[model samples]
Target: MTIKLLAIGKTDHTDLQSLIDDYQKRLGFYVKFEFEIIPDLKKTKNLSEDQQKQKEGELILGKLNSTDVMIVLDENGKQLDSVNFSQYLQKHMNSGIKQLVFVIGGPYGFSPEVYQKANGKLSLSKMTFSHQMIRLFMIEQLYRGFTILKNEPYHHR
Candidate 1:
């Protein structure tokens, strides 16, 4: 199965992008991983929070194929540790799905429509994180999860 990460906006910080790239390369050894950035909405200062979410939701939903299983990275979603997350990845692989898409929404978070289309929701932490930082965190976790699954020395546990 292919694991895809879709997030809103590009990472402006070079340091963060470099780290994300490194993990992405490491992940390629274990699985086909794709990181896609959805461009930020224009004239956001003119739109209301709900309006922005609605527009962003459209862009997010447009990226998916009919068979893709979308899981949104939501603040109120389920949180799992590295080991459990590895098992979660294993479960999805065993289920024989084509693509597993995890989305990171814009500033106001996902819209009702986006939430409704999601197969599941996952949270990296109870505390909030910047969208750019979340990209790195998510990618690094994916790499860590694969290492755990392979019994690699990368993960201490």
Candidate 2:
């Protein structure tokens, strides 16, 4: 299955960008991977939390294709270890999905529509992490999962 990461706004850290790029390139060898950025809303001070979420939800849902299997990277979502995460990837591939989309929502998190569209949710960690940092972490985990699947030296138990 082709894997896609849909996150709100661009990452400002050049260092993080390079690291994410490195893992993305490495992951290409195992499976198709793509990262798409949804531009941040211009003004939010006047908007209610619900309104902000609704607007961003529209943009997030717009990126999806009907056949896509969406998974959200949510704080309260199911958390899995490296081996388990790799197994999860294998299971999705076995299911014959066209695309596996994982969304990292905006600052306030996902709206009802976005939540409804999601097939499942995954938590990388119990501790909170900055959205910018999550990009690097997600890509690195993806790379690690692939290496584990392939029995490569890139990752060890």
Q: What does candidate 1 score on TM? A: 0.98
Off by over 4 Å in 1: none
Model 2 Cα RMSD, Å?
A: 1.0
Per-residue CA lDDT of candidate 1, range 83-156, in tens?
A: 99999999999999999999999999999999999999999999999999999999999999999999999999
Global lDDT of each candidate? 0.97, 0.93
lDDT of 2 by residue, 46-148 (tens): 9999999999999999999999999999999999999999999999999999999999999899999999989999999999999989998998998899899
Best candidate, lDDT? 1
Clashes of each: 0, 0
Q: Output the number of the TM-score-best candidate.
A: 1
Clashing pairs in 2: none
RMSD in angstroms, candidate 1?
A: 0.8
RMSD of each: 0.8, 1.0
